[model samples]
Target: MRVVAIVLLGVHLAYAGTHSLKYFYTGVSRGIDFPEFTAVGLVDEGQFMYFDSNTMKAVPKTEWIRQNEGEDYWDREKQKLIGSHQAFKYNIQIAMERFNQSKGVHTVQMMYGCEWDDQTGETNGFRQYGYDGEDFLSLDLREMRWISPVPQGIITVLKWSYNRAELEGRKHYLNTVCIEWLKKYVEYGKSSLKKTVSPQVSLLQKDPSSPVTCHATGFYPSGVTIIWMKNGQEHHEDVDLGELLPNEDGTFQKSSTIRVTPEEWKKNKFSCVVEHQDKTVTEKEIRKNNASDDSSSQRSIFWQWIWHLKLDITVG
Candidate 1:
């Protein structure tokens, strides 16, 4: 009997892009309350995000293992780190081979972009995309259905990876083990704001540097807005916004710089304002003594305060 896979009710537009990618891999592990998985992405091999069941957020693998996991954790779980990294490389190789069977067309880049929805629990899926954003394969775990066509080779690989016995074992794990874990993880992730720290904003200009930069550091939750103002007027042009980088402690930092002549800088009141969780706003002003262009100032501009004002979150 020829049986066709179920067609999803809704129409999905094929994302446009070609994949010049050669490899991608996803590794899943059992956790107490939440499962920890790492996907060695096609875009950046060996560079991927790690989500700990305890943390309930994706962190840099190195930072998570070294700082968060601690020495005791490593000592207790011997070979876990080495095994995980080795498996990561091995999976990318598998992904590379699978990529060849995807379309047989011109494919150079591979993509691995998948996300899980802890809120609904069942709403999780994985997708492989081309460079133009077109999907190669997509799976909807909620329905246990494929959103796109599943090639015969891919199905064969999946079956070979997990036969009837393994499939039943997976069901047992998902039903029994994952239920409690998902609930706790969702709760922890929501209450994470209780441990929030307001950002430390600094306006700095080093020796031999003409640009004054505003640096915001040590804030939880990556959503932050930074702006440069001159004499209380916001200036948009000539502002360079840096990427939100992760700290060793899982907090985030970002910077914005603007070029200003020494004369213009001295004449104008320059300030940088940052907004983070719960409308917490921190603003800092930049000033230098006229004695030398490189001297740093000690005058505090503004004490950090929380404003309930609704403001647009402009993260660039």
Candidate 2:
């Protein structure tokens, strides 16, 4: 009940060298209306598998995974998630007792992942736990030890630290098994993962007194740059850059706003430039808001604009 949604943003690498595989497991206490336990698996920031107590099954979220993995694979994943779900239920109770909390919503979460840099042949692994939106414990892979940020987690750290076999098994999985699986998934979805789509850049202005916003959406790979130029030179003052956000279809959207008075804008040539992958969009290529646009299309764009603005405020 009252599930804690964890949004993990992948590091946008300038080069296509780094790739990651991550898993998030969330367990909530009883007396809530939602599922007690839910798990998600992501490869390169794209969700590929999901499981929940209500479904009692692990399902593939991507066509590539469904095509590449057989029923046996889903069965194994389902069994593992079921076991984890039971453990999370018990752990949530224990955590409540430790915190002297009862009869209220509480959450136990685990996030573990591995990252590989193919070009440099570098690899890293991490495993961390959280309770009630705060860090509870984490594993130091290099030192092969558990660490707790809160006093309530000390007991768990002590108990898990003594399990040498489990620690070793976890280390093996993170360093070896996890990396192997990540590589396989990358190969399976290489076509979709590696493809790129150019963005549709637009210049939006609500009114003469409002800031001019450069909006770019429907870009692939989630990496793009937006900038404002004044009189053929890059202008940074009074500019706000928005965070990259995912569209409903898995592409990305970003915005950059420049504050310039109407007089200054009219006196000088101001431009918005967007760069993505190998393409560069200049002001000459941007679509401007116009009255000729259909009302329905304009309404859709207005809502999207408002949505992004709200998201930017929330994320800030």
Candidate 3:
């Protein structure tokens, strides 16, 4: 039997030379509530963004992962490569090989985000986990930008309208994303646009031992906070938060980094919080222990990376 992947739907923005992307995850659930998993992504231009429910967090690759995972993110993350979000190890290596052969350069971005549906007759949305992975799907955007906080509500519209001059109005780009899926704004045809925004929190952790170095992964177009909390206290020393990486689609990702000590990490509670639009939200807590330590003790196995398809832009 052949497995069909969910298609990412996108629409052209009028007057604006851009597009937005959303992916529907299709997989066999066998009728069971699943676990919660978040997606993380990165780009060739060093852009990063991610969405967990309605919270989108954008930041530089190095710092975000570091903060959330503490010292173990790097090690445990490698183990996760075999699970939901497979690293570009295989695909990126292939792209590099092709570029090596042609002596040319091309750019691509990586993204990881979590999904869920609340069908428990209780909550509002949907989310759950199953198998080694669940209904969540991993995606890649070659040239398209993932515009806006992955739009909210039932009715979402992206239109590129020409700059209409009201006699002498300011030269506006004339773009909007209408979120009509909610109760207050549900409309079949004529509805106003909801100003959508996504923010991110870039977390970084330095070596508890010595010379602290930071490296990480991320998605694009997010608005949030990037701070180091020691024992739940905001520690703002030796930290460098970077600017947001704007997506070709319009949204952006923010980031930052810092180095501390094992003595610093063992203090109490450490966390990175991302508060963005969409009524969406996400967060991560750093434990003195790392996921890699668990994997090592369990003697886990992993799969290699590979790219079976090439992503190209399409238009109607």
Relative to the true structure, how large is the alpha-carbon lDDT of every model? 0.41, 0.73, 0.28
The TM-score between candidate 3 and the true structure equals 0.26
Residue 100 lDDT in candidate 1? 61
- Every model's TM-score: 0.41, 0.70, 0.26
lDDT of 2 at 193: 53
- Order candidates by TM-score, high to low: 2, 1, 3
Candidate 1: TM-score?
0.41
Off by over 4 Å in 2: 1-15, 199-217, 225-245, 253-275, 278-316
Q: Which one is best on lDDT?
A: 2
lDDT of 1: 0.41
In model 2, where is the ten-residue run with the lowest total lDDT? Answer: 307-316
Residue lDDT tens for model 3, 1-316: 0111111111111111112222212221122332122333322122232322222222223332333344354435434433432222233334434335433322222322221121332212211111112111111122111222212210111221121232112111111121112111111111212334444332323335642322121333233455555565776787766443333333334444555666665664555544443343334443232445333211211100001111211000
What is the descending lDDT order?
2, 1, 3
Root-mean-square deviation (CA) per prediction: 16.1, 7.1, 19.4
Q: Give me the overall lDDT of model 3.
A: 0.28
Q: Write the per-residue lDDT of candidate 1 for residues 1-316, one digit (tens) a residue.
A: 0001111111111112211111132232232232332222111111223332233333333321233445564444334434443544344344446546333222112222322243343422232322112333333335443333335235533543345564455445445444443333233233222455678787776643578878787775556899887888888878888655444454556778888787877788877888886564546555442435322122111111000111110000
Q: lDDT for model 2, on a 0 to 1 scale?
A: 0.73
Clashes (candidate 1) = 13
Better of 2 and 3 by TM-score: 2
